[model samples]
Target chain A: MSTTPAFKRLPRAVREQQMLDAAVRVFSRRGFHAASMDEIADDAGISKPMVYAYLGAKEEVFIACLHREGTRLMEAIAAVVDPDLPPDEQLWRGLRAFFGFVGAHRDGWAVLYRQARGEQPFAGQLAQMRTRMVEVVAGMLGRATAAEGREVPATELDVMAYALVGATESLADWLADHPEADPERTATRMMNVAWLGAAELLRGNTWHPSG
Target chain B: MSTTPAFKRLPRAVREQQMLDAAVRVFSRRGFHAASMDEIADDAGISKPMVYAYLGAKEEVFIACLHREGTRLMEAIAAVVDPDLPPDEQLWRGLRAFFGFVGAHRDGWAVLYRQARGEQPFAGQLAQMRTRMVEVVAGMLGRATAAEGREVPATELDVMAYALVGATESLADWLADHPEADPERTATRMMNVAWLGAAELLRGNTWHPSG
Candidate 1:
């Protein structure tokens, strides 16, 4: 008798990834509430039991998608930005990386930014990613200001970072909606709006309320 | 027998509003998917049939809530901002009014900004409001630039306004999460980020990527 197994079993890692890709696609199409395990399993070409075994319940599966995609986006930006570069250059790179990631994974972007932001448990995942991104952006903002021989109050810097990141994400969301928009050009447009404005602040031109 | 009717029938306008208030409360607490017509009707002190009679369906009820609150927010900002004022002052007043509206109706803010940005019918509602707000912001951005003796490309202004509005919405989201935060102070923080950055862009501090 031949001793070889009849079918080759995929590794657990490969199976998990396949499950997540299917989940993100289905969730993007069906939304979190309408998406079903059967559809995701079928999309993965696996049994529902296999999906549950690898990714736990429906909620866990959605969260797994959020974690994976969120990590990828953060890493992509982090990989490109250099501390020694000028702030505009660093921001340009970071935005290029971000829009590139979103352009590459439009479905994942929809699931993470569009879908998971409503429900409580899933919203937390998106919020945590946002918090981390805000901190990273804040650090970059602070470092750049210090290099320019200026200081933005820490409290104010925090809000500024949040606003910059928020604005970038909004443009990213816009890119996600328009399938043909060029990420590089879009990033430049964002730089004009964000960094140009920020440069003025760096140059100590701030708005004051009149009495 | 007296000609007066024993029971008062709430006019369609009043009844429709009551149903919306109930739906907003339920949707805010239970989320869009989990909220039930029965519960919404119960909360409004009306019967299920009556809710349907006034609002049409769950979907329509939700849209009605969005329409009402979105209109209210726009009106509040419109009431405060004067076109005759300089761009900075107009933006300041707009931001202040926006934060105040959000603070006063945190639940409505969640339903309008956070919860409704996902899914189809609901997302469409939010997107429409965002489009309106973007156009207004774009007009303001255009006016400010023109006042400085220059004209920005229409396409660039569109994206620029989008980013600025998105940042303000993010701060509004932050204010939604924080119950203890003061709306006026929050508005000031946002103005510092948005207006200062905008002021620089107006001064022609554009970022150029080196070839």
Candidate 2:
């Protein structure tokens, strides 16, 4: 019988990432309470103790997954946005990148938004992440309006940013159910609502900025 | 000492609703897997057998809760929208009702969106409810644009409806964090995005629609 040699061992950083990847997949599917470290270890093709050694507790593993996935999503959006582009164009690209990322990495998005946010124990941490994300989006909206040479109220911009983010998220949820739709298609749909509505706001339409 | 009845004598429909209300609260808080039937019974001020008899099984109880809550939400939206009013006015009323319902019944909203959508068996039902909601919004969009003598594509309207729904849901989640914010305020914030973006689309601004 011929014996296959074991794959070469990886460094702690690489192994930790591997564990996080597995945890994200499992947690996204089964949620926090239903997911077990043993299942995660099995998914990663690593032993149980090694998963602990690399990732600490289940909560820590979940946090690591959020960090990895959230950062990746932010970077994905950044890659698509161009500062020199027209304001509408920049917003369009960013929305497209966001839906694309969610479509391609559904598991990661689910881990960050659905699983982690649903866990009460992690609510404080999740709130911080949410605030940071909101700030990033608010910053983008501010930049876009500034490019248009319009002085949009920061509060109005903040509300718009929140609405834009929410719309993207709801569309993403819709897309998850109808998997046949392409990410670009989803992004385009979102852009129509976001950019057009945003333009109306900039034109000083009667749309009240309530919250 | 006077004693309350053992819950066995309660009418079936009344008892069922009571159990469902409890289930919604518990399920929303602890999620489906973590929420036990025993605790649900306790929350309902009843015994285990009474709960079981009133609502078939744990899953059945959850489904019952979802159906009831979803119906309540749809009704709220329906009640607020005036068909005779102009499209924009109708949309505003609907948005207000949605935000109002969610603000007052946060647990119901959580159960409908977060817990039910996250749990497996109930996910399909929630998906259907979500689709129905999008359809309603799309229908309204169709009427509004047509009344204004504009002809946006059905696909664009569908996407916009999705974004509108998303904006409402996102505001709902945000309200959980900022408890002091009123429903009217949240509704107004959503209307700013919806009406502005929607009016722009009717005017041929060509904001790229998402998938």
Candidate 3:
């Protein structure tokens, strides 16, 4: 038998991922403050010193986890959306992907996202990720409107995108909290609210207040 | 001249308001962690011990500010909403009041609300306020659907309310960040997005995914 542990035989990249997976579980279960590095190392089947050497301190480990999860979420959405598809289809697909990710990773959504939302440094990172999502949504809206020969103002598109992103996020939070809810149905409900309003807007139908 | 200071003559209720105003300003300028009781006292023109006597510690002072601001926001929305009015009209009035409040108190929104969102104790308070808002919104939605002879499920109404509240909150955050933005105009934009979709839903029009 080899003297080295089996984990030692793995490549550095693979080891790093294993550490991140363990870290995510710990962070999810214990939150940012209560979570300990020792637990993370134990969960990863690696020693504490090796965990620190590989991913730095606890905060650094958390940031790495956040970055990985965020990247995975973005990649999940990006993989499904195609510019060539109709706007409604793109939105439906994007939303379905988003809710699916949240549903599957409820713990990650609760701890990484909800916890980071109110905290300082993590909030900034989360904000950066949100800005990217808003930009992507705005681009999709812009393309959708252009296809319909309407030139909506960038600010308007941005605001609408903000609303959409915010609404979707709120639903994701709701989904994370509800263990019995179906992600696809939640996505469908979102489409009913989002796509309907967006379609009405694209059709130049405005809701004017009646006195 | 009287031996007592001029501030001493003020009623307890009046004095408390003064302290809270100062606390809100300090908390806004210097987030939750960075804000100090000393600065709050100085700004309010009250003594540090007096400030502590009135509002307790820094955390308590922050909570007091949050409670006051949240109460004011809820009152603003409640005052504008009338059951006799059409659902769309009621929604418009509520949204206008909400944006108006946010516009008038951008600092409070940034500090009291945003800062509390990620932090622990304050986050719980904020969630309570959000739940109240969601309830109010769901009630309005239920009334609107009932008037139209539709009996929507409570869970569905709650979900829709969550999406609306989330979207509105997102836009309010945007408005707070954009000093040049007009609150009324922002409210109108929100109306366009919200009312339009809600109107469609009321009319029994739903967006279906096309293969």
Candidate 4:
């Protein structure tokens, strides 16, 4: 063997991926500030400097984790939602995908939604992610309403989108505490709520006791 | 002059209350770890040792704030919820009170909900508050469904409560970002969703489109 170092490690790209996986697990548990680069490196079975070299600083690691997890979540919903399907079915598909994603990746959802809030440097980035999420729902809501020739005012549309997203996120946090609850059951329950909620709003149906 | 200081000069109870108020403000903004007892004492126009004397420690101060705010929020809701009112009206009343209180005492709500989540010693207390909230909604749901001669399944009731509470909390967060949104409007939108959503679920009326 040559005098130079003989035992080479994994490539930079693979190491970066490992570091991100470690970061997500750590960040989700400890939140951002409490989670350290050294812990992430130890979790990844690599040295701290090597992990830094692949993932930059701690903030970059967090951003990278969010980007990956966010993309995965968005794609999960997009994959389930077929434009060719009817509006209601499309909405159902999206809600199901969302609840399912949260059920499966509770940690990732927590890190993105709960842990990401309150911090300054990441707050803007979190806001951007939230905007992207709201836009996706708003687009779907607009399309669904338009397909029925119903015109939902822009402001109402925005409120509806926020309500839907908020309800789902809240359910996710509750689900985290109640792990005994089945994911399918949870998703169905949410789907029922979302479907009924969206339909009533779209048709301008108001709830009052029978008079 | 009396050797003892007059109540006007500063009673212990008054000083303690002042310290608690200052602690709430600082802890709400900077969270538990970031907030210092010195700053809290300064904010209260007292010395650091006094803060320690009244509150014991930083964590103790945070727990005290949580208990105080949690009690205030629960009391606000209880004060608004009239036992004699119809279930739907009772829910509407509760929602209005909730949104109104959140809008008015935002710092308290932030301390109770956001900052309290990260700290372990306080999470149990926060969960207690959450349980009380869920119980409030569950009681309403139970009463609403009682007239139909059948109880809503506890699981389903839990899910509905989560959705309503989640929507309200989410709306509160959204309202924080967009202050122009009127509290009345926010309350109305939330009530509309809750009352309508609850109605459909109670009737077992799933909103699936006709195939």
Question: Which candidate gets the maximum DockQ versus the true structure?
Answer: 3
Query: Each candidate's DockQ score against the native complex?
Result: 0.58, 0.44, 0.71, 0.41
Q: Candidate 3 chain A: worst 10 consecutive residues by lDDT?
A: A1-10
Q: Can you tell me which runs of candidate 3 are displaced by over 4 Å? A: A1-10, B1-10
What residue runs in model 2 are displaced by over 4 Å at the alpha carbon?
A: A1-10, A22-43, A56-62, A78-90, A110-113, A122-127, A142-155, A175-182, A208-211, B1-11, B19-43, B56-60, B82-85, B110-112, B145-154, B208-211
Where's the lowest-lDDT run of ten residues in candidate 4 chain A? Answer: A1-10
Clashes of each: 1, 15, 1, 0
Better of 1 and 3 by lDDT: 3
- Write model 3 residue lDDT over B1-211, tens digit each, in one string: 4465767777877999999999999999988889998899999998999999888999999999999999999999999899899888999999999999999999989767878987778888998999898898899889888889899899888888989999998999889999899998898889888779988887788888887
Per-residue lDDT of B115 in model 2: 64
**Model 1, range A1-211, lDDT digits (tens) per residue?**
4343646344666778888999999988888889999999999999999899778899899889988988888899999999888888888999999999998998779666787776677777788888988888888888988988888887667777888888988898888888988888889878877877677677777666763
Model 1 bad stretches (over 4 Å): A1-10, A146-153, B1-12, B34-52, B56-58, B146-149
- By DockQ, the better pick of 1 and 2 is 1
Output candidate 2 Cα RMSD: 6.2
Residue B113 of model 1, lDDT score: 66
CA-RMSD of model 3: 3.9
Give the top-scoring candidate (TM-score): 3
C-alpha DockQ for predicted model 2: 0.44
Who wins the lDDT comparison?
Answer: 3
TM-score of chain B of each: 0.91, 0.88, 0.94, 0.88
Per-residue CA lDDT of model 2 for B1-211, tens digit only, reads: 3254667556655767778888888988787768899999999999988788668788888888888888998999988787777777788888888888888887667645666654455766876887888898899889887887887788777778888887877777776546677888778777777787777676667654332
Q: Write the per-residue lDDT of candidate 4 for residues A1-211, one digit (tens) a residue.
A: 3242535444545667778888998998787778999899999998999877777899888888888887888899889888778767776777678778888888767765556654545555766777787777788888888878888777777777778777777787877667677766676777677667677877778654332
